[model samples]
Target chain A: MGARRETILETIQQYVDLVATGSSADVVALYADGATVEDPVGSEVRTTREQIAEFYGALDGLEQSARLLHTRIAGNEAAFAFELVTKAGEQTYTLAPIDVMTFDDDGRILSMRAFWSGEDMLVS
Target chain B: MGARRETILETIQQYVDLVATGSSADVVALYADGATVEDPVGSEVRTTREQIAEFYGALDGLEQSARLLHTRIAGNEAAFAFELVTKAGEQTYTLAPIDVMTFDDDGRILSMRAFWSGEDMLVS
Candidate 1:
């Protein structure tokens, strides 16, 4: 929905919205073709366009919100500190951590590496 | 001593050596022009080539070692988790935090943002 480097901040916000709305395809488009996501508990999840579409399809009745606390941008990379409050199935989880996101010069998110602790997830 | 991208890891290692040896000039060259350094206590220190050289000239005696615990690289960006053990003036300080370094396509470090706590600095 936005051009390169012009709406980077908004692009990330859009992805957050998609997650909250349980729309994974929208979230996945922000990434480059060969994109990867790492979970808090040292899990590496690779995503393809089709896989992302299917993953979101499974989270049918989930409600989620990603609250952005702070954002720092320099050149082609941006770091965001955010909290994810999500309710999937019958339980809710809250995760607060900082994530480093790298964008290609064209503003497409090339990779996203999230940093958080498993202890926090367990407590949440 | 290395080419762009080929020795990104070695380049950072070299900077760590310069710090340990109190060779500020060598450390300063790793930064791009108009580079900035921030302290854990919320101080933004911008450095120019000349200022860095002068600063190193003053540190006649110092011993330091930046032991890298982990490094993650993706595309043109790299993040390093390291501990800086230094003895300067009559004091020794140990700072352990992960720093995100962005390198230009040419392998020159454009920006480095280190994430550490001020509390750690005071204790060390």
Candidate 2:
């Protein structure tokens, strides 16, 4: 909770950017040592660093672009809506996920829970 | 987590609607008897029905309009961003609060945590 507002916001942006243009390690680096990730909410949580990195490994290489639609930073927790577009050959799939993250005093993410499902995806 | 996606979404809409135009009791009715509300995340958690109603009492009689910008329902939980505009005399104040709620089988909200702070408010 000691993190400044700008610090938290910057981390969120960095997270989105890294997922779009960087390696899985880049995204995993944003989390604290004991962080957990539950992308899509109901999935099994990724607790260890190796597991967390593996979870993001799906985005290691792809034609994707991301942007933050809206964000709310409160205390050490943040909830944000973001858009991600993945291009595969002739089809383009878009999904907007609302991610909730709790951060530590050091500004590293403590836990991340994303609110999204296949029903929310749109392909064009 | 027994609630359907549609039911959860409907309850969220009803909540926003009641806050904008109905009485505090009307809004409190959407919650389960044991529901808890932690507005702005860092504030005190309101647990009892009377306490929760008291927290929302500030909006009992105000000229306000509310709308949901975007929402995501996963499992029995939903997270969304919405805007509330209050008009007093010639002044207008607006706030976009991102709310995360967990619903029961009957679609009654069990816990609602709002992710917003005073820094997110604006006046014009």
TM-scores of all predicted structures = 0.48, 0.98
**Residues A1-124, candidate 2, lDDT per residue (tens digit)?**
2789888999999998888888998899999999999988888998999999888999977999999999999999999999999999999999999999999987899999999988999999
Error of 2 at B52 (Å): 0.3
| lDDT, candidate 1, at A52 | 50
Specify the highest-TM-score model's number.
2
Worst 10 residues of 2 chain A by lDDT: A1-10
Error of 1 at A11 (Å): 1.2
Q: lDDT per prediction?
A: 0.62, 0.92
lDDT tens string, model 1, B45-124? 54666755565556546666777755545445566656678776788888766567667666667766765544436333
TM-score of candidate 1 chain A against the true chain A: 0.75
TM-score of decoy 2: 0.98
- Name the lDDT of candidate 1: 0.62
